[model samples]
Target: MSVSSRPDGRRNHPLSRPVDVLERRVRIGIVTVAVLGVPLAGAAAGGAAYEHDRAVAEAQRDQWRRTAAVVVSEVTPGMSRGDLAGDGKAGTAQVRWTAPDGRPATGVAPVPPDADPGDRTHIWVDRQGRVATAPLNDTGVWAGSLAVGVLGAATAAVAGVAAVAGVHCLCEHRRDRAWEREWDAVEPEWSRRPHQGG
Candidate 1:
């Protein structure tokens, strides 16, 4: 990759054109940033998500509790909050339970799909006596953090690929134009010379 100059002190190789040199540098910088920055951004995103989610989980754990509840109505298939509904098997049920304050509370809770009326099932509730889901466990928190990290990294990688492709497209267009300009300069001189068919 040594560059040579013509008699007029201009670069002799087409690749050494000013625009080409700029494009090459831009490509190297983009690749370097993509390789180093994407992982760092993903790790940062993961750490932020973990810390935020962990804090919320801790608060929820402190304010909520698990208690025994007797189902007052048949637990039918219905959407429940959080990941409970994600599994597609849990159902909603009307339940009765005593709060920590010794006050009776009645609410709908998510129960197993097989729960029937009068069945005793465990449920979680918040301090305000509202039916609630359990706080996220440690594994859930880590999984959420990992998902955020992976998404961030994937997005960055895609952007990097797009940038590289755009740069290459521009370089190709410039090279084509340069070839046309060189041909235009040589065609006249070549046309003046006589050619033998033999």
Candidate 2:
């Protein structure tokens, strides 16, 4: 393509417009960068996200703990319809338990959906001894990192394609305007008749 951009081909070849070579080169450069840069950016994003999330997860796990508690009320007394579909997963309830210091303690906790009064269930507690949701697990950290990476790569890919297309459109406009200017300069004389000394 570069070889055909010389004056010989620019003036004689129907397809070798001067603007075409620049457009092709720009397109190739854009594609090359996209191919190499997007994945690199994604990997960098994913790695950074993973490291950040992993640190957060470690800190959260260090400050939370799982313990045994007993349900003191019906799981459905404070819940609406279908909140406990009997899948046996955790459901909100008031519970009784002994704190790490052996003093009796009670708070709202998550227990088995099918739990009744006196049923034991495991629950998590925060550093200050309040019932809390479990901390971030490894799976959640990995999933978040993967999502960030994928979204970053996808957005960059779209931007790259748009840039190449934009360059191509600009080149096409330049070539067409050049042809139009040449035609404008020659149209009058070409339209004149031979007897009119055109």
Q: State the lDDT of candidate 2 residue by residue for 117-182, as single tens digits.
A: 998887777777777666667777888899999988888899899999899889988988888888
- Clashing pairs counted in every model: 0, 0
Per residue, candidate 1 scores C-alpha lDDT tens digits across 1-198 of 777866866665745677787787799999999999899889988999999999988998899888999999987786678343145568888999998888988988888889989999888888877788867888878989999999888888999999999998999899898888887777767997544332
Model 1 regions lying over 4 Å from their true place:
1-16, 82-88, 176-198
Ten contiguous residues minimizing lDDT sum, candidate 2: 79-88
State in Å the error of residue 99, model 2: 5.0
Report clash pairs, candidate 1.
Answer: none
**Candidate 1: 10-residue stretch with minimal lDDT:** 79-88
Instruction: Quote model 2's TM-score.
Output: 0.72
Best by lDDT: 1
